[model samples]
Target: MNKPERVKLFLVDDDKVFLKSLEIDFLENADFVVETFPTGELCVENLSKKPDLIILDYHLNGIEKSAMNGISTLDKIKAVNADIPVIMLSSQDKIDVAVDCMHHQAFDYVVKSETAFMRLKTIISNAFRLKKVEKELKWYMNKM
Candidate 1:
């Protein structure tokens, strides 16, 4: 039997305790490779190492306190790697914010919940599988 691919997820949240708790959950239950950063700036700085997916909070402390807000951080990341999937987490219920995030090409926007976490795991696994197949097919085509 073949082993499953482990999903590499980078989590960015200003709340240190939240990040630590998520790191624990990802390790203990989801079997994912989780790296936690207290802020998006650090995550972006280290992203040259490249993570398969990113989980970001909508409101981050110490980020640009401007009209753009989370979109600014998201923009910085997307600029470097347009294809890297990003999932947004927010406690806010404002439709405008969610709409703007999705409009900016976030893979998904989610309000944190137990169900959401499980779904995140599933999505990560499926996305990895899809990307893997695409890579294989591209290689085969190049050889042909």
Candidate 2:
């Protein structure tokens, strides 16, 4: 018998408090290895670590006026590795914003609210399940 690998999650948010709280929640509740980034730039710089998923704040420039926004960072991340799933997390609940993130290939968009953590947990589980199925399909195809 072998132990399963823990999921590696990269959480990028300019709000330090929100980021820390979310990180703590994930660490305490899930079998995840979490990394917190205060800026999208820092997340991009650490992409070499190859996190399984990323939860990025839509408004990343809140703390830094000149920082790259979530969409831009998302683009950079996709450019580096399109396979890595990224969930756009934002305070904005507008449909247009969520649509924009989906257009940019976000795995999903999560609005900041009391239910956010639960929603995120569900999304993460679904994403991983899908990824596993995809991989198994690819393997079967290759065998055939």
**Model 2 TM-score?**
0.97
> What C-alpha lDDT does candidate 2 achieve relative to the native structure?
0.96
Which candidate number has the best lDDT?
Answer: 2
Best by TM-score: 2
Write down the worst ten-residue block by lDDT for model 1: 61-70
lDDT, candidate 2, 1-144, per-residue tens:
999889999999999989999999999999999999999999999999989999999999997899999999999999999999999999998999999999999999999988899999999999999999999999999999
